[model samples]
Target: MDKETAKNIRESLKADCSNCFGLCCTALNIVASSDFAINKNAGTPCPNLNDEFRCKIHQNLREKGFKGCTVFDCLGAGQKVSQNIFNGQNWRENPEIAEKMFSVFPVMEQLYEMIAFISEALTYEVSFSLHDNLNQQLEKLQNLTDMDADSLLSIDLVMCRFPIKELLLETSQYIRSELSSKVFAIKKGKECSGADWIGKNFSGKDLRTTDLRGAYLIATDLRNTDLRGVDFIGADLRDANLSGANLSTSLFLTQMQINSAKGNEKTILPSHLQRPYHWI
Candidate 1:
């Protein structure tokens, strides 16, 4: 796929909450924690969700102790499930299908997330060799979204994600290798994949080409860091300071990750990502 086509696909994968029926607020379970004010069960609507299927605390989610709600993104699965799958019928109005709709939501979420990653992978010129495979996988995922609710529920997400994960890793390596030079390497340590760097001071460091997949970077100081070409898939960036950090070319950095972290107006992000509303 070409860049423009890939861009369009990525845009479609973003959450359009206005067109949704509050699936994220009703379909998923919530655990009481630092992020959530109350425990909620799956298939139950949040107390804060109003009659119009909107969150009453939409603007004050964090202050109201629903921090987890702010960090969650369904990757457009909510609307897809609400409108496309159910023909605009909402769970509150159509009580008979409520349980089935809730069950299909998480499955759709996984598919959309995979599609988002593959769509991004296809945009990198360095990963052109994998473009054919990526496009095929993307097509497969798109087709899966069109499947009936029962078919969607039957999907084994583990099996579906295995190949996509391998492809993303390959794409990340190709892009990073093409962009990063020896000067961008970390001098002290060679490995960073899945490393536990919580609360570590890495501010202003050149972290280019670092394979930081699944790294625990919670509360880590990364302010003003040069992070071009770093792979951040599954990295715990909650409370990690990103003020003035340059991630314009970072690999696999998602909106959810950015939403969970802290940043300032000086922080640079990829062209496709939106700066969080809370960022100063």
Candidate 2:
């Protein structure tokens, strides 16, 4: 596919609540804990879900103990199941299919997540060497998404995600290698994975192309840092300050990570991600 076509596919895979039927609010259950306000069953619709399929407390989710809702992104699976799988039928109209719909929703979401990330990888110039292979896999996964609900439910996500994860890791390594050419007297060589750095100051540090996987960075300061190519897949960023940080090209950074961290208008983000509502 051309660059523009790939870009469009990436954009299309994003969460568009206007086109969705609040599937996440109904299909998934939540416990009364730090993440949510109350306990809810899998098939039961959330009380905050309005009749119009909109979240009543969407704007005030953080204040209402539903911070989890603000961080969640279905990656376009909600509308896919609501429209494509069931022909725009909802659980309220057909309660019989609710259980099956809920089951299929997660599977489809996983597929779309892969679609989104793989498509994004294709946009990077470093991924050109794997373009043919990536395109072939992307097309195969897209075709799988079009299968019937029964077929979708039978798919083993573990087996499917294995090879895709390898591709992404390879892509990240390639980009990191390219970035290593730029010289800078910065703290660029460090293995801080699984290390406790909570409430520590790292402002103006050069962490480019660093391996920070599975690191504990909760409530840490990272303001105005050069974070390009940093591996933040499993980093704990809760309450971490990222103001003016250059994460626009960061590796493996997700919406969940961004939501957990604190940033101002100056903090740069990836092209496909939206700024968190709580961010100043």
Candidate 3:
């Protein structure tokens, strides 16, 4: 899928979190962060993950030093493959079938990567012909991704490894420099508001003076996406990875958005800017 299309799918996904089964946190091997010192095996739920499936340590993950967990984004793996495909059966509640679910998780994760990449590819006008090819691949991945755990585990691991590796490489390429030829120009100055562009590749695109107020830009690859002079007022920046992103001159950056966005020690904030209160 092209970049634009990928973005659209991702945007719709954020709104559907409640439907997810919390699969990644409960069904995969995760080395804990400060808040959670222990690593968890596939099919075992994280202790910090609460009954509601929300992270009990969400707010204090880092101060509590669970930095490793804080950076994770299943890229909506929980909702798309787990909730929608498997009908929300997570490994935690099905230990007898835990191995089956664990085996299927990576398979679905690879597919989720494809979905995200294809969605990104679809956004560009020049990639129109790619639509059919992407659709085919997406359908195939979706089929495997949505399979019942029994069927999912029965697949040959040796045979499936090659395809997953190939897909992962192809998907990675799109996130790099592939968009230079299809650079975006917001002509007609069409207004965009409250849009969800999380985990997308809007890198290096000039979004100066754009109105992105209240948009959900979580984990978006904005490395070089221009934010020289835009309104970021009220945007939900929750864990939106902004490393190397230039927001030094952005406008109306609310305390909430700044707090939600993730930054490192090297982040260059404009003078008079205050770090978010909870980013520790």
Candidate 4:
């Protein structure tokens, strides 16, 4: 796929709550914690979800103790499942299909997430050699999304994600390799792939091209950090300080990760991402 096409696809992958049926509010289970005020079972509508399929406390979700809701991003799967898969039929009106719809919702979520990653990977000039492979995978995943609800439920998400993960890793390496060897030498022995750095202070550090994939960065401090070309896929950034961090060229950073973290107007983000409303 060309860059323009890929950009359009990436734009479509963003969440459009107005076109959705509040699947995230009803289909997913929620536990009472700092992120949530009450326990909620899977397939049960959140008490705050009203008849119009909108959150009643959307304007004040954080204050109302629904922080989790504020961080959740369905990547446009909700509308796809609501409008395309089930033809706009909501679970409440169609009780017979409720269970199946709920089951299919999460499956679609995983698919959309993969699609989002692949679409972003396609736009990288460093990954040109892998573009053919990436485009093929993107097409295959897009086709899967167009499948019926039963086919979506039958998908083996783990198997589907394995190859995509490998591709993303390869793409990440390509992007990071463009940096000078001296830069890597400066941060030698600081390889943090999947490392536990929870609550660690990394304020004002030069972290260019760092491998933070799957890293535990919960509540870690990263204020004013130079994070360009850093691989942040699957990194837990909850409450991590990003007050003045520059992530303009970071690899595989998503909106959900940005939303879960704290930042300010001074934080430099990629062009495709929006600054969180909660950010100061």
Better of 2 and 3 by TM-score: 2
lDDT string for model 3 (1-280, tens) is 5555554664443323466666666777866554357878877777787887778877877777665554445555657656655666755575565566556667666556555444444443333434565566556665776677677667665575555445433433332223222333333221355888878777667775565666878778776565654556546666676666667645445433555577655455643355544444
lDDT of each: 0.88, 0.83, 0.57, 0.89
Query: Model 3 — which ten-residue stretch has the worst lDDT?
Result: 172-181
Residue-wise lDDT of candidate 1 within 69-176, one digit each (tens)? 988899899999999998899888889999999999999999999998889888778445589899999999999999999999999899999999999988887777
CA deviation > 4 Å runs, candidate 3: 1-7, 15-17, 32-36, 80-95, 127-129, 154-280
After superposing candidate 2 on the true structure, give the runs of residues whose Cα lies further than 4 Å from its correct spot: 127-129, 182-196
Once fitted onto the true fold, the runs of candidate 4 whose alpha carbons sit more than 4 angstroms away are 180-190
Candidate 4 local lDDT, 1-280, one digit each (tens): 8887887887777888887888999999999999999999999999999999999999999999999898989988999999999998888889998999999999999998899889988877755569989998999999999999888888989999999999999888876776535344443224579999899999999888888999999999999999988999999999999999999988788889999999999999987788999998
TM-score for each predicted model, relative to the true structure = 0.95, 0.90, 0.54, 0.95
Residue 201 lDDT (model 2): 96
Candidate 2 lDDT over 33-107, as tens digits, reads 877989999878899999888989888999999988887878788889888998888787778888999889989
Give the TM-score (vs. native) of candidate 1.
Answer: 0.95
Better of 1 and 2 by lDDT: 1
